[model samples]
Every structure is written in structure tokens, then in C-alpha cells.
Target: MRRFSQFTCIDWSGAKTERPNGIAVATINRDGPPKLISPEPRWSREDIRNWLFHAAKTEQDMLIGFDLSMSLPFHDIGCYFPQWEDSPSRAIDLWHLVDQSSNDDPHLNILSFLEHPQAARHFRHSRDHVGDLFTGGTGRLRVVEQYQRETGQANSASCFNLVGAAQVGKSSLTGMRMLHQLDGAIPIWPFDPIPETGPLIIEIYTTIAALAAGLPKGKSKIRDRVGLEAALQVLGAPSPGPLSQYDDHSTDALITAAWMKNASRDKRLWHPTKLTNEIAQKEGWTFGVF
Candidate 1:
């Protein structure tokens, strides 16, 4: 397995604002515990994209994980949009389509894409306004998400369900735009070949990191210093000292960064048992799923 000098976890948001409180970033270097990085009071999607581009140039052999689905379920239905001929066939193309459709939206928001005539039919916009084509009780799940479910990990919100608090559709859409913008600056895993050096981006489920920290399923969100310290210690990462706040977003980023630091060393994760060439191209795998 390839070694990493640093690990980063970004808890992303897709709110339509200049700065979203849900966004949080944390990183761990070669020899210490992970610490939150807040260059500003709040971060926007564009801010993260710029920061990642800079990190890709400066950081050495880093693994960066984002808590959002990189692409929607394609293999489950044989295509992203069953009847739409214009639907993209690959993850990269999907990113391009999302970015292009939402190019005018501020702060990399994906409102335009959500409201697009064709795309709008695939997502569950609200409890009473579920799209006609939004299939399944909780929307479609990617192959990796199905694996997570079968293995007893915390259930991941489908990328097509934009309704409840657990919904990841908005975050995933906004994240796709960022991925499209960072196309050549940094290579995203599975979608792009793993570069021998420099940073690589991967889809991450924070709950998976929380599970690795010994937290039971469904109780993965750590929101207190005591809980945060206990989880960090379990990952063999030292204490980051007192934090200004202990919200789930901040704690999730911190714990996942530490988890990534240790988990990246496991060779099996780089090559999951079920990840195949087609899945890699259409629906990217989450780093810690396997």
C-alpha cells in the first residue's frame, strides 16, 4: 500500500450561502493528533476547492476524504437516469454536467441542477414533493452503500433523497461541482488513477470513521470533549487539546482525519473486495467502506 505523510477529512455542506456552518476541515501530519483548520469563521464550497488545490501543490503524499457521495447510484439502475439519453455514463462526465448546470449558482450551490427539468425528476426535494422518478423507500443506494448496509455499518443516506436531516443529496451535488473544478489539480480515487505522490481525494462516510473509533452504530456523532478525546485515543492519535466548540461537524472532521491517518495504511481498503472497474468509473467507492 502507498504511504501518506498527512491525512485530511472535510465534513462538507451544500447550503446555499456564502458560508455554511456545516463545513469543517481537519488534518493530521506525520506525527501528531488531528486538528481543525478554520482559516475563516465559516467556509464555503469554493473556499474548500481553493484550499484543496493549494494543499495538493504543497502537501506531500496526503489522503483527503470528503463526507459526501461522489456520484449517484448508476449500476443499481443500469444508468443514472434510466430514460434520459443525455445522462452521463461516467462519474467524471456526471461531475461536468453538474458543474455546467450549476455554474451560475453562487458559492458552488447546486440549486440549478436540482431544479433542472430532467435532473429534478430524480431527487426527492421534500417530504410532500417527492420526485415522480425517485424510486425506493429511501431512494437508490450505490453499490458501496449497499455493501455498507449488508455489513452492518451505519446506513448511509441515499444521494437521491434530499428530504430529512440525514439526506446527503445536496452535499453530494455540491461536492460533484468541486470535484469537477479540481479535475486536473488533484486526482480523485477510483474515478482517476491513484497518483504515486501528492494528495488523493476519496468519498468518506464519517460514521465509518466513528465506527472504527469504537463508537456503536447510529451513535457515531461525537459532540463533546470527553467523547472526542476517547475516540481520538482509540485511533492512537494524541489529544488535540481543548477545542472552541464540540459540534458534530467539527468532531466528525477531527475523528475522521485521525482515522484516515491510521486506516490509509491498510492495503485492503485501497482494493476493496467488491470494487470493480465499472463501479469505479460510474459510482466511486467510499474509502473506509471495505
Candidate 2:
């Protein structure tokens, strides 16, 4: 059996079918570069579900981190479906719809209808973009609260755009972390050392920590240009999802680049609470933070 087993990352673009186009997967074994799995022949929902169930069933302590938004008190995706109004009891009803739909074709299973392709298409096409859950409203908090009460599992998974954008670096960065673990360089914490945080937490956090510790802290310096470029190339691509197979080293490099951007003379406005307060009071980050 492979020591590291499978560390899979997916980029979900909300395609009509199950398999997305820009999807990528990477597997890391004991001490080796993250071998990229073929992007073609994308995986189906059934495949993913089966894999998840199998992993959960067999690996008592398996660490399966997905590059998607997970529902907790702070993050809510159902806000996109204002009509869903009811959560917990009402949310359960919506889950039934998703469950019912998922049964039709295991491959085309929709984990949540609110985040369905149809809804995404409607939003993308419609002139009046509906307010999303992140915008706050639609009683999403109440619904999520009820869900936590019933399931006792606060982490409800959903796809996110940022994960796909940061996939390249995330995948490589994760690979590096796994390698470090194998080499006994770092201890894998139960609380997950990687701290992208929020809905789409990726292993980039680990890479960032590594970079921060190794590189001189000159208000965020660029450690590696090549790695940063690769990361940007992936992020800049018009992809579907934010979760992708990113490597740990490259992930660290990208964080360094972001810091460099922060350190840039043009990016002065990004720092200092006064500028942010002034911007927030006067106009907004849209006018200046760019």
C-alpha cells in the first residue's frame, strides 16, 4: 500500500455534467514529487463519493482536505438561494431535493442545488445578479445553525471559485507538506496546520508558514519568481473552480509573491488601518485597494 496514499484536489467549475474541464488531481507517496494525475477523464460524483466513503470507512485517521467551501457558522453558501428561506427543517427539505436529484445519475449528483450549474448559469446570464449568501441575508445563518444542530457536523462541503484559482500552487504546496511530514521535518497537527482558513482552506497555509520562517521578513518578500509565476498563471486562467492540485513549494512561492505585491510602492494603500478606514468611510476598497 502507498504510504502517503492519495491526496486528491479537485477544481469544480459547476459544469453541466459531473466531470469539469479544468479539474486536476495529485497523489503524493512517501518522499517524492507530487505526481499529477491526468486531468482528462475527469471524475464523476459517484467516483468521488465512493472514494470518500471508502476513505472514511477504511482510514480511521485519514486527512482528506477538499478545496471547496465548507459550511460553518462563519461561511454560508445557501445565501445564494434566498427562496430556500427555511433551513434546518427547511434546509433538510432542500437536501432532499439534492439527494433525490443525485439518485437519478450517480455521476451527475449535485451536493447542493443552490450551488447547481443551473443556478450558476442563471446568475452568470441574468442582468440582475441575485444577492449571494456571502452578501448576508436570506436567513442563511438560521438554516446553518439548524443544520449544525441536527447533523452535529458543522463542516458542510461546497465548491468555491478561489480554490480553483489557487489550485496550481495549492497542490504543489500540499505535496511539499506531505513530503516534510514523511521526512519528519514537521509534525502533522490534528488541527490541520495549513490555514488558508474559511470555506476553502488549502495547504497554502503550510507553505506560507514555511516561507515566512525561511525567508527574511521584509514586509513580505518574493522568495521565488518562477514558482510565483506558475501560481499566477494558474490563477489567471479562466477556470471553473478554485480547488486544484497545488504543490507546497510553489504554494509558498506564491505567498511570497503576494507579500512582494503588498510591499510594492503601488500597494502602499493595502497597509495601515487608517487608509482602510478612510477608504471604507469615503468610497470603498474598490477605488483604492487595486
Candidate 3:
């Protein structure tokens, strides 16, 4: 098991704005508390990517986690898009397709593909337009999503659902496009082999990471300075002073980064039995789920 010298977590936003209210980033070294990197104001996805690229060049081996679904459900139909022609047969292929389709989209926005006649066929964009592609129902969960339930965590949203605040469909789509851009630069765990020593990216659910640090469910996002510092202390993180005004997004990223720093030493998270070759190629595994 290779130990990461640094850990980072991003609380991603799917908004199609230059700077979204939901975007936040946090990072921690091996012996320190996680610090909020986007504390001054809201961050954009592009800004986050540039920061990561810079960190990759300057930092030691780091494990970066994004709070978003890496891929859609493929276990049910053996493919993410079952009835669509030229549909991607694997998860990486889907990332490539997203990248290719949204080549003209600035900032990796996914609106271009969302309205495409052929590409949009695979996505259940709304409640009325349910097609052969993935639709959000309790029964059609991906294998990795099932793991979320088995682990006593809240069941994750289907990547196909494109509505509501909890919906991750748009985020996952844009994230795939960005992942394609970063293909050769960073290895995404399970989908790509983690290197012996280097910066790597992984899919993470902040809720799972928060639970691992003994923070009670539904009450983990602490905004007050005292509460935030106490939660960090539980994760063995140093005190984070003076949280005059903070939101859940920053709290989520900070806690997740701290938990990731601690959880990186667990070898079992790297090689899950659920991460079969097929799932690795299609439905990517969520880090720390297994």
C-alpha cells in the first residue's frame, strides 16, 4: 500500500456559471489539518482544475478526491447506453465520448450533449422523458450504488437523474469531460491503475468520508469555528481557527480531505472485491465504499 504525502477533496458544483456557489476545495498534508482553499469566494470548475494541475507539478504523491459520480449505471444493461448506437461500451469510453461531444463547450459545460439528438438519448434528463437509457428508480441502482446501501450509507442518487439539488447527473457528465482532458496526467482509481508514486484522482462521496471520522449522520457539516475544530480534532486534524462564516460545501471538503488523509493508509480501499474488471471498465467504484 502506497501512502499519499498529501490529500485533497473537492466539493464540486454542476452550475453552468463562471463561478458557482457550491464549488469548494480543501487539502491537507500528512501531519496537518485540512485548509479551505476556496474560502474567499465561490470557485469555478476550471479554477479547481488549474489548482490541481499546479499541485500535481509541485506537490508530492497526492490523492485527490472529487465529490461526484465517476460513471453512470452500467450493470443493468451491460452498457451505460443500451439501445443507442455508437454508445460507449465502457466507462473510459464514456468519458471520451463526453469529451468528444462537448469539444466546443467552453469550461466543459455539458449542455451541448444534453440536447444532442443521439447523445441525449442515453440520459434521462427529466421525469417526463424516460427512455431505454437510465432512469432514476429505486430498482435500477448501479453496483457501486448498491455498495453504498450495503455499507449503511444513504443511497446515492442515480447519475441519470438531472433534477433537484441532490441530483448529480450534470456534475458527473461535466466531470467525465474533465476527466478525459486529464486522462494521461492523472490516474483515476479503479478506472485507471493507481501509480506506485504520483498524484492520482479518485471518486469520493463526502458523506462516506464524514461518517468514517465519527461525525454523526445528518449533522456532520459544522459551520461554527468550535464545532468545525472539534470535528477536525476527531479526525486527528489540527485546529482550524475562526470560521466566522462558512458553508456546508467548505465543511464537506475539509472533513473529507482530513478523512482521506487518514484513510489513505488502509490498503483494503484500493482493492475492493466489487471492483471487478468489468465494473472497473464500466461502473467505476467509489473510493472508501468497500
Candidate 4:
């Protein structure tokens, strides 16, 4: 595996608004604490995509982690969408399908995809409105997510469930749109082989970062400088000092950036015991889940 000079983690959002307050970006390099990079109070999904393109051009080798599922579950059921002729077979194709289906949505929102006649059949839109094709029981789990569950790590919500505060369907779908737009400028790991040079993107679950930083399960969220500094110290990273805000999103990005700086050193993460070539190309593994 190639060494990365810098590490960045994005706490992404899929809110329908033009600029969702949930978006947060943080980065760290070889010798400093992670710092938040905010050009505005809130960021639109397109803003993050543009930032990444510019960073890929200017920054040193970087490992960027987005807190969203890179691809939906495909292996468990033999395909992403069972019995659906239009279901995509690979992660890249899935991204294209999502992007194309939601092209008319502004601010990179995934409303159109959620409402897509064929695509909508797979997602749970609301508490009272479950799609006819929606598979029951927490929807479906990607192979990586199943591994996470078996290992007693944090539990990831199904990319098909969009009904709760903890659900990640919206974020994952929106992220796919951004990934498609990126068009391989920054290679996404597992889906794309690690290049000898340049930045790489990977699916990340912020909870995994928090767990690696020594936080107990179910208590991964850090909301203050004290807690944040403690987690950073556990990861061998110095404190970023004071910040104007200490919300969960900022802290999640900050700690995850620091965690990636250390986690990337483990080559075994690049080849998990459960990940197969097929799973890598279709389901996509989370960076720190191994």
C-alpha cells in the first residue's frame, strides 16, 4: 500500500436544504492535530465535491474518508436489487445509476432518487410508507456491515432504511452522486486499486474511528474539546486546541481524520479477512472496519 501524506475525513450530510449544517470537513497531516476546514457556516454536497477535486490537484498524497456507505448490499442477495432487471452489478455502475436518477435534484440532494419509480422500490421512505420491494428486517446488510456486526463493532444502518435519525440512506445515496461526479479523479479504494500515487477515497464509519480511539461502544460521539482531546491522544495525535464549536459533526470529522492518520499504517486493513474481490467491487468495505 502507498503511504499517504495527509488524511481527511468528511462528515457528510444528505439534507434537502441548499447548505446543510450537518456537513463538516477536517484534515490532518504528518505532524499536526486535525483542523476543521470550513469556508462557510454550512456546506452543500457540491461544495465538498469541488473541494476534493481542488485538493486532489494541490495536496500531497491523501486518504480521504467519507462517512457514508459507498455501495449498497449486493452479495447477500446475489445482486443489489433482487429480481430487478435494471439493478446495477458493480459499485461504479450503482453510482452512475444514482447520479443519473437524481440529476434533476438541486444541491446534490437525492430526493429524485428516493422518488424514482424503479429505484424507490428499494428504499423505506417513511415510517408509514415502506416500498413494496423493500426487504424487511433492517433492510439488507452489505458484507462489510455483516462483518462489523459479527466483530461486535458499531452497527451500521441499512442503506435502504431512510426512516430514522440514525438512518444513513440519504447520505449514502447523496454520496454516490458525488462519487459519480468525481469520475475517478480520486480513485475510490477496493472499487479502484490503490494507485502508486495521489489521493484515495474510502467509505468510513465514524464510529469505527471512535472505537479505535478507545471510546467505548455506543459512546462514540465526542462533543467537547476535553473528550476530543482525549480521543486524539489515544490515537497518538496532538490536540487541535480550541475551536469555536464542539458539535458532534465537527468532533466526528476531527477525530476520524486523526484516526485515519494512524489506521492507514495498517496494511491488513487493505486486505480484510472477509473481503473478497467480488465484495470489493460490488459492496465496498469501510476503511477501519477490519
Candidates by TM-score, descending order: 1, 4, 3, 2
What C-alpha RMSD separates each model from the true structure? 1.1, 14.8, 2.1, 1.2
Put down candidate 3 lDDT per residue, 35-74, tens digits, no spaces: 8775455677777777777766764588999999888787
How much lDDT does each candidate structure score?
0.89, 0.31, 0.79, 0.89
Better of 2 and 3 by lDDT: 3
Clashing pairs in 4: none
TM-score winner between candidates 1 and 2: 1
Question: For candidate 2, lDDT tens digit of each residue in 164-268?
Answer: 333222222222222222222222221123222111112212222223334333222323444434443433311112334344433433333232222222333
Model 1: weakest 10-residue lDDT segment is 38-47
Off by over 4 Å in 4: none
lDDT accuracy of residue 35 in candidate 4: 94
In model 2, state the lDDT of residue 46: 41
| C-alpha lDDT (0 to 100) for residue 244 of candidate 4 | 93
* TM-score per candidate: 0.97, 0.38, 0.92, 0.97
lDDT of 1 by residue, 224-273 (tens): 99999999999999989999989999999999999998889888888999
